[model samples]
Target: MGNSLAAIGARHQMWESTSDRLSSSSDSCGGPVVSFGQALRSAMETRDDPESLGTSSQDLADVDEQDVADSSRKSSVSAETAEKLCTIPREKGLDAQDFRCAMCRKTIGGSTFSKFETCAIDSKYYCTECMKSGGKVSIPARVVMDWDWRERAVSDRGRAWYEANQEKALINIKTTNSRLYAHAPALEETRKLREKLQLVSMYLFTCRESVSEDFRRRLWPKEYLRSEIDVYSFADLIDVKSGALQRRLNSLLKHSINHVMTCTLCKQKGFCCELCTVNEVIYPFNTESTHRCLVCFSAFHVECWRTSGDCPKCVRRQNFETRRAQVDDPHNTLLVLQP
Candidate 1:
């Protein structure tokens, strides 16, 4: 009987082991029968109980949702921080809304604020520190080389010298008929120079005089003028004058005409003498030889006098012989001297 009992116990233990294996496999694969290791691994992978795996389905879901929320929060925070940096005023020791620093009374950095510091005592936009430290920045007025005419004017002694000697800086005019026509050559050239000077001078004067309270009150103020003038501005002016003078001189040298052509007999190109006119002496005068007018220095054809009513060369010349005869003896004396 004892031996029979021992055999029955052994059979029961084998059956129990088989049952445990089947239960584990069914839980892992949702099916019957699997390898022990595979069943254990699968059970671990799909385990949902918090007590066994140190986590639950609800807890994992909560962690994933929390991660997404944290990432979104970080992105939003970064965007807000960037916007704040962009909006912040760059000026030291000043708030965004304030134009002046409360502690230092200096101008704050902002689009709407003036760059200059203000003094409380003088009610002026100039700081004591800046004034004390200045070599030239403290000066009320600035000298710009490009627009120095007015600055020179302000310094009257300098202006007077410039005004008196400005013409010497100009280019001279050239002409072929230097003897007969006095005004045409120099006057024309000087007129052109004067025009150019006037234009440049006007521009300079306007710029110099533009600094005013009324002008500054506008939407956009002019740039601050530095005290020292640059050498380049004066150099540019000189260069312009030199170039113009050189070009004109070159043109005059290359294209100048030396002489003029004119009529020979009766000393006129038009209104021939009564003797020549009545005789029909059209071919009596030479047209080939070049002759310049003594009075006007113009050139004309000698044969042109046959039909011309007046002297072509001497358009403004008076018939003083007729006038003088009228003054001297009325008219008979002129006829006697006519031959």
Candidate 2:
């Protein structure tokens, strides 16, 4: 951009000098005067300006307008790069894939042997938490030194392992594609349903830890809480039906709800019933009570909500439903005639 600006200003200055010289000389030779462009070019050559002294009309004409434009574009790109990075990203040479996270160093791909637990933000090569808030934690100088030393110890491990297991990875990819193809007939309807929704899944943003923990006993049936339970593989052991799964999830979310997506009616930023009385005597549910409206995702106190089985806060949905059902009937079926 600086180069571009210099180039433009140089041309403008040359033009101004040319015009001034032409006008100044035209009065002296009124009958026969040199061409304004010629006088401008000659005047520019005589001037001490850096661009004017050696530059010719030919050089000015040959000035690549594209180059000047490209200079500005490059500057813009650099600015965009800085904005996205926000903070300087710690550089790495390792081909970090599903093995481990870049920030927290957690595993991305867990399976039976690996037991991968969560999803990765593939675009940024970061975990979701790392993407939300940059992983900037203070550490001791000694800890940093030790970590670097340990990392260096396994510097070429990723490359070496990938080289050796390239065939295995290829085979796994082929096997996955083949298995997915085999299930094409079964998953066709499911795929269509997902497409219809525009890929948006309305997941309950409730307490995940407590909900997952609640299913631990059912998963094991007999094993202790600390025992390593095969959750995905041995999920059938629990015999929880699909509807039961949704019900359990909702139940867990309702009871353990805290700072969920938001409170719908009150429009607060947490899992709370603002309408519920603060006093212990008035509010019998106390800290343990919670209610969730699956329709509108609103929650209120158990006692306050009562057995109404209707969302007190879903007036919008009710209006929408009413409008949708309102149709012109010749006999006036929906409304009673005033007559």
Candidate 3:
């Protein structure tokens, strides 16, 4: 009876183990096997509607475009602001129409246009012509007595007289050795006479001395003598009556200095050395002293030719000669046979 009871107990244990295995298999098989991709797809499909998704993307794109447009508008506004900041304001009370001559009532245009400034003391605007006329208008005391009085005083009539006298004076100085040829004295005296006559002419013509030092420099450089004349020696006897010295001095100053050729090799701008012409490296067989290539008519320096060997385009023509000479040569044929 004990043995039978033991066997029954073993059978009961086996039945419990089978029941657990069946429960585990049923649990695993009961639910559908969903893959990671399918689960993600289902989640996404449930969470978002197709129309809503498209609307979201469109909204984001619109926002991005709006941001870009806003940035562009800001850049344009900044550019405009920079331009406005950099622009210079026009002078007050002065317009394009106000630039005309007040006395002659002629439109001042191009190079003849006169620039005017209001006198600080007088508080009146004066054109170059009106100022030169020496009318009752008040002018700066400094401007009237400036060093450029000779140029400021010259008139149309005075200019003609000066030109004629200047020519005479130059001739007289050149032909005869006189005290007038003594350099400073002659030049200064001529300038003084010209200045006096110019002042008189200015009063008679334009009435003011509006011509500046710059205008004088451009128009009459001879009227102002700043340096000592180098054309005459003190030992030379000069006639004070004849204006020979002045003419000689003017001629000497006006003479042009001789310019020499530049070297292509040394890159020197002034005169080239005679020795440099024979230099093989500097003046190559194919290159000229003027920096021109003899073969192709192109230009290059000695240094550039050294690195490139020969003219880039012309060197190809030498290949046929090289091949012909090499093929015909006995030494090349021997070397080819030995190799």
TM-score winner among the candidates? 2
Which residue ranges in model 1 land beyond 4 Å of their true spot? 1-240, 258-339
Error of 1 at 39 (Å): 99
In what order do the candidates fall by TM-score, top score first? 2, 1, 3
Q: How do the predictions measure up, each by TM-score? A: 0.16, 0.19, 0.13
Candidate 3 Cα deviation (angstroms), residue 43: 99
Per-residue accuracy of model 3 over 224-314 as CA lDDT, tens digit each: 2222122222111132225664454333223211100121211111111121233222211112332434443333454554655555434
The TM-score obtained by model 1 is 0.16
What is residue 200's positional error in candidate 3, in angstroms? 42
Query: On TM-score, who's better, 1 or 3?
Result: 1
The lDDT for every candidate, in the order shown, is 0.31, 0.33, 0.34
Q: Write the per-residue lDDT of candidate 2 for residues 1-339, one digit (tens) a residue.
A: 466546645755655454343221122222332222232233334333556346677776787989779978987865543232222234342344546655567555434322222211112244444444332221111111121111111112222332342222011112223343234332222223222111011121122444334534433342211121111111211122123433443343343333222423111222334345342211111223655454444445677678555654455445444543443233436444344
The lDDT-based order of candidates, best leading, equals: 3, 2, 1
Q: After TM-score superposition, what is the CA distance of residue 170 in candidate 1 from its true location, in Å?
A: 16
Residue 263's lDDT in candidate 1: 16
lDDT of 1: 0.31
